[model samples]
Target chain A: MTIEHSILGVIASRPCTGYDIKTEFEHEGAGMVWGVSFGSVYPKLKSMEEQGLIQNYRTETKGRMKKMYELTPKGWEALHKWLGELPSYPSIKDELLLKLSMWDRGRPEDRQTLIYHMKNRKEQSQELLDYYLQWPQNGHSSISEFGMLGIQYVQERLETELRWIEKAILQLEGEPQPPVQDPYDLIPKQQERRNLAINPPVITVHPESSTDEDRV
Target chain B: MTIEHSILGVIASRPCTGYDIKTEFEHEGAGMVWGVSFGSVYPKLKSMEEQGLIQNYRTETKGRMKKMYELTPKGWEALHKWLGELPSYPSIKDELLLKLSMWDRGRPEDRQTLIYHMKNRKEQSQELLDYYLQWPQNGHSSISEFGMLGIQYVQERLETELRWIEKAILQLEGEPQPPVQDPYDLIPKQQERRNLAINPPVITVHPESSTDEDRV
Candidate 1:
């Protein structure tokens, strides 16, 4: 549903071929917000035209014929309707979070490797955020004001992730447990053995800060 | 790939029927990390069993037959292999971000509606964070320490989102444009109309904060 509306919205701004639409999404301004492959765009364009939401005309560029699409009245109406409706909740699939969830079940080396990877991730995020901060100087129009805001939003998200990674590394360092225990050893060899029998591990709970309640 | 490792990791901790595995995922500890519907789980389990990564046996309980799965040696090897490998980068498909990208093209009423929806989203995120904060009191074991960290990660993410939304609202409020012009009016009725002649609205660039550079 979002892809359909996003494509329509882009076309409503100006007439473009399917290839043009794909290129626009790959550009810095719209890339992160509405990235899609040629595989998805071609079929959607054909279907939207068949549904009379968009109309296409043949144009010659560089002595080659290309079909360019523009929003019909129906397409404009559909785009407006979508804008008025509330969007569905975003579902996240954070792979790093998935790995972190099971980190305690890994060996000490695995944990170290995870930390190393996280540091690399932190650097990558910083690079992306830096690139986004330069969007204003690139001469994007007032109509792209919202797009710039979206970039700022992503920048904040990356910042938060970097902080979390630092905190996690600290927590791992402060852990009182012995280093490099095999995960298989954490499980008892016999059915009667229990986790508590292995060690009297000290658990540190983060103290609740006053700031925790400030946002809520 | 994460799901396959997640399933193996769960089974390695303890043997369980597919029904039991489903229940575990719906439970508080594992639910957030590896949420999957029965439709995906069942097929994945069948294929994994055929590939010799997992094996199953029938057990009768309460006059009914239940098929339980356990990790084979190969499955254990596979899980460990995955743990040693670097995780894939998380790909986000944020619908709200998508809407925000095109927000400048929306009507005044549409922008107001978006603000309302963002507020609602903020509340929902707060509720989830609050629920996660209570995990320590619920007696999750030391092995779930990483899981607890993951909850904190999500909580911080939600808080960041809320802050961004507030900032976004302020930016929208400070917009100098007149209220409620038809979007079509922004476009030229004549074919030759170029975008720049539409008053070239001033875009207020956000000032760079010292904190932004501190992370990098």
Candidate 2:
């Protein structure tokens, strides 16, 4: 549905053929700002025409026959309604957090893995930040006013993400305790060996072992 | 695959029955921190057992025979590999951003919608922020040290999102101009009528009308 509305916006901006619509979404202001993909365009164009939201006509240019699409009155009304629709909560599925939740805190190697992923994610966000700074100035026209608003928001988000990564790294590096029962004891053979041993390092290494909350 | 690893993590935390695994995912620290769900757990458990990643034993607890699952040597090896795997870039598909990029800049109604959606998103992020600040204190135990790192990251993200909303609103309210070609002209009858008019409001309404970039 957003794809249709974006197409309508491009058409509303100018009467363009299907190929022209693809180019705009692939190369123009909306493409970079909205993350609109071109894969869904043709099928959506067909359905939108069938639904009477848009209409197209055949035109010949440069020895090619092109179907140029534009919004019908119905399309304009739909685009207007879509532009006003309330947005929903953005779904969050951060893999780093997901993996970190199950982490083996006693393992030094696991801590290193945690830092590796944080840096990887930060690098990717940094690349996006770099692109945002250097785009539009390259060749194509500047993004529209509303598009600028979206870009600016993304810019802040990536910056906050980078800053948060730094703070989290410092916290992890400074931390010194593993907070749960070591899963190694869940193995029966290991559990039996530990139980048979006289005073063990579980008591030796765990200075906070007397706390009730750490037991479960 | 992530589901499998998370289940492995839970089993590694403690040797637990299938039902226990479900409960932990539904009501424990891992659920909140990782967004793990129970829907796919049973099937993944079945496949994991077949693949030598886990083993289960029948236990009679309070007259109910339950299948308790535990990690194999192979399972521990898999969990280690997963925790070390370099994380990929998080997928971002923000609906508000996708819509904002296609906005009808000439319509006051459209501007209101943009502000409305921005505020709506901010309010939701604020609710998450309130939760981040208030949670764990309400419950069984404070999140593990690493879990604290993930929560702190989310806390900062939501705050940045809220602040970005304010800045975007200011930019939108302070500025004007419908950039690119207005889709209105694509309507043939409207285009013809607009062309026929001696002096039009496109000239009157568009103050940045003379800027070459504004012409699209």
Candidate 3:
């Protein structure tokens, strides 16, 4: 979704400046999930204002002036509708998995690099989850609740990924042990061999010596 | 990356027509990770040929003609550079987390939706990973290796996420018992209050008298 919708969602609750929205990301732990940048937020907010979804007003605070934003009636309606239609779950477009699909053709070193990156991410995710639990944020439980939830989500995913990395590392080392069944299992069955011969049958005897019965 | 690059990487391993590339994604296991469509592959092949990354030739076979493609030296170089460059790891941009981040101001129902969404995603991810691992590949260890690596990565992440979902569900239910704490520990120290008074302390007389005069 566009940053506009995200910022509007924030503004829908209460009026805020672009800086306020940026600060809100850190304050509310949005950085942990959405990863919005001020660069994208401000421009999108301006465009939203232009589109009449939000309205801006100048306000003086401690001898400084700032443009604070508020959702317009239209914006409120739009945000409400958006919220109503919001998908129940998160949609992920993971580029790493996409790259892994081509791993067979990729250089072994590249696969190693991907594994290395995931390892670091996994550790970071685990640490963050631990840190969240250690903090014991009671006063801001309202906010921390979500942060805790996200940290939990991320940490679990990371740990799962670390296992995959270890497995990948093992696989890259060499071909895994093959099953120790009879090697003949790898060969085709007799009926299939007979069918293959019949399709393009080669005569052991010369064609001139072959009788009609042999040909048949 | 673009589908063209993905196609290029696949073709660089061996000459293949657009149909072959499509088949690679469809019939082969490539679709599990690297997805490409026939409509896209044909256009990209045309573009690559025009750019000299590949060359096409036609051959007659049993009164029929077949078009074949082979990578040019330039294509190999391009693929080489792509392989050498840094690979981007997967990014999870979950919008539900965005909503959950706002749970502080959101209605309880919204938070409930977010929780349920995460739980569903956890289940779905696990299912997909399990399905990917069901096949028993014997000879192509590389494919099996990378395939399992990708699947396990996602599977472990799902388990991690499931834990988070459980945590969130508990929090939404109540204060989560503030985790467990041993009563044997000494009472925690009180935090010092910050001084934010607008005016300095007043030099007022004591209720009974002046403090200095009383001491004298």
Q: Candidate 3 lDDT, tens digit per residue, A1-216?
A: 546667876675456788888876653452244456789888888788899888889999998998988766576556545544444444344545645544444443344565565556556555655655554443332333454565556555555665666666666565543322223432123224323423545655667776668755
Model 3 ranges with Cα > 4 A deviation: A12-14, A19-40, A61-64, A86-99, A108-147, A170-216, B12-43, B57-70, B104-106, B109-123, B135-144, B166-216
Top candidate when judged by DockQ against the true structure: 2
Model 2 docking tier (incorrect/acceptable/medium/high): acceptable
Q: Model 2, B1-216: lDDT tens per residue?
A: 466777877776667877777777554542233444456777878999999988899998899888988777677768767878876555554678767766642133457668888888887778778877766365443356676667777778778878888888877677565443323333334334223332232453666556645555
For model 2, report DockQ.
0.24
For B67-182, candidate 1 gives per-residue lDDT tens digits of: 98877667766766677677766656667777776655544334577777677777776776676666545544234556567778877887788788888877766654441222
Model 1 stretches astray by more than 4 angstroms: A29-31, A106-109, A141-145, A173-216, B23-34, B60-65, B140-143, B170-216
Give the candidate number with the greatest lDDT.
1
Tens digits of per-residue lDDT, candidate 2, A1-216, equal 456667877776566777777777554443133444456778888999999978889888899898888677677667667777786655444567767765642133456768878888888889878776665355454356676677777778788888988877776677655543223333344334223332232453666656656656
Q: Compared to the true structure, candidate 1 yields what TM-score?
A: 0.76
Worst 10 residues of 1 chain B by lDDT: B190-199
Interface RMSD of each: 6.8, 6.8, 10.4
Model 3 scores a TM of 0.62
Worst 10 residues of 2 chain B by lDDT: B192-201
